[model samples]
Target: MKRAEVLVALGLLVVALVVLSQAIHLGPGWGEDGPRAGFFPFWLAVVLGVSSLWVLVQALRAPGGAGARPFFPVGGRRLVLTVFLPMAGAIALLEVVGFYIASLIYLVIYIRLTGRQGWPLTLAVGVLFPLITFFIFERWFLILLPKGLFGERLLPF
Candidate 1:
C-alpha cells in the first residue's frame, strides 16, 4: 500500500510538472481581455504538484516505510471493478451515443445493478437526469454538447 501510494504520488507529480510546463508556454498571466489561456491550468497544476509532493513525502517518512500491507482487502477489487467497469463503459459509449444518452444508460444500469434500487426510482433517475442535464447545459447555458451521430437526428431542438 505504501509503495502504491508513493508511486501514484510520483506519477501525479510528473503529470503536474508536464502540465505546468505547458501552461507556462501558453502564458499563465492575465491579459487585457482577462485571464490567459493557461491561467487555470497553471494554478491547478501547481496545486496538484504541491499536493502530490506532500503525499510522497508523507509516504516516504512514515514509520515502517514500505510496509507489507496489501493494496486492497478481500472483496475490495470486486467492488472497485463493479464501479470502474461501468464508468469505463460509459466513457466508451460517449462518442457513439453522446453525453446525455450515455449518462442516462450508465446511471440506469449503475443504479439498478450496483445500487439495487427500486425500478421506479431507477427509471425516474435514468430519464429525468438526462432531460434536466440537457436543459441545463443546452437550453440555459447555450453550451453545445456532443450529440453523437444519432443524437443529432433524434433530438428535435
Candidate 2:
C-alpha cells in the first residue's frame, strides 16, 4: 500500500511538472483590462506542480504512515476503465460535437451514471440546462459557444 501510494504520488508529480512547464512556455497574453489568457492557467499549473511534489515527498518519506492507505491497489482494472472510458469519449465528442453539445452529453451521461436518475428527469434537465445556458449566453449575453455539425442549420433561425 505504501509503495503504491509513493508510486502514484510520484506519477502525479511528474505529470504536473510537465504540465507546468508547458503552461509556462505558453505565455499569458494580456487581455483588455485583465491578465493574459494563459495567466491563470500558468499559475494554476505551478500550484498543482508544487502540491504534487509535496504529496510525493510525504508519500516517500512516510511509507507506512499511520493513517495512510494505498493510493492504488493491485488488479484495479475496473477503476481505471471506469474513469478512462468516459474521459476518452468526452475528448472525442469535444472535437466532433463542439463544446455545448459535448458538455450536454457529458452532463447527461454523468448524471445518469452517477445518480441513476429516471430517464424522463435526466432528459428534461439535460436538454433544458443546455438550452437555458445557450439562450442566456448566446442570445442575451452575446457569448458564442462552439457550433459543430449543426452550425449551418442554425444560421437561418
Candidate 3:
C-alpha cells in the first residue's frame, strides 16, 4: 500500500507540475482590469502540486513497508473501462465535432445510460448545458472556441 500510494502521489505531483507549467505559459498574471485567463487555474495548479508533493513525502516517510495488495481490486475493471472508453471517445470527438457538440453527446449518453434518467431531464441537460456554455464563452466572454467542421457549416455567428 505504501509503495502504491507513493507512486500515485508521485504521478499526481508530476501531473500537477505539468499543469502548472502550462497554466503559466497560458498567462498566469493579472491584467489592468482583472485576472488573466490562466491566473486562477495557475494558482490552483500550484496548490495541487504542493499538496501532491506533501502526500508523496508522507507516503515515502511512512513507517510500514509497501503493501502487497494490487491497486485495483477485482470487479473494478468494468468501472474503469466504462469511464475510460467514454472519455477517450469524447477526446477523439473533440477534434471532429468540437467541444460543444461532443460534450453534448457525451453528457447525453452518460446521463441516459449510466444515470438512468428520464428523457425530459436528460434532454434538458444535453441541450441546454452546451447551449448555455456557448453563450457564456462565445457570446459573453468573446472567447472564440474551437468550432469544428460541422460548426463551420451550421453556425453563422
Top-lDDT structure, candidate number: 1
Compared with the true structure, all predictions reach lDDT values of 0.91, 0.74, 0.85
Superposed by TM-score, candidate 3 places the C-alpha of residue 78 at a distance from the truth, in angstroms, of 2.0
Candidate structures ordered by lDDT, highest first: 1, 3, 2
Could you give me the TM-score of model 1 versus the true structure?
0.60
- lDDT per residue for candidate 2 within 32-133, as digits (tens), equals 897766777777777877887787787678748656654556657667877788878876886676666777798789779966899888888888887898
Q: For candidate 2, list the clashing residue pairs, or say none.
A: 29-36
Candidate with better lDDT, 1 vs 3 = 1
* Candidate number with the higher lDDT (1 or 2): 1
> Judged by TM-score, which candidate is best?
1
Which 10 residues in a row give candidate 1 its minimum summed lDDT? 62-71
Q: lDDT tens digits, residues 1-157, model 1?
A: 8888899999999999999999999999998899999999999999999999999999998665445677888789999999889989998887788888888999999999999999999999999999998899899999888877777766667
Q: Give candidate 2's root-mean-square deviation (CA, Å).
A: 8.1
Stretches of candidate 1 off by over 4 Å are: 2-67
**Candidate 3 C-alpha lDDT tens digits along 75-153:** 7878898899999998888778887888899999999997899999999999999899999998899897777777555
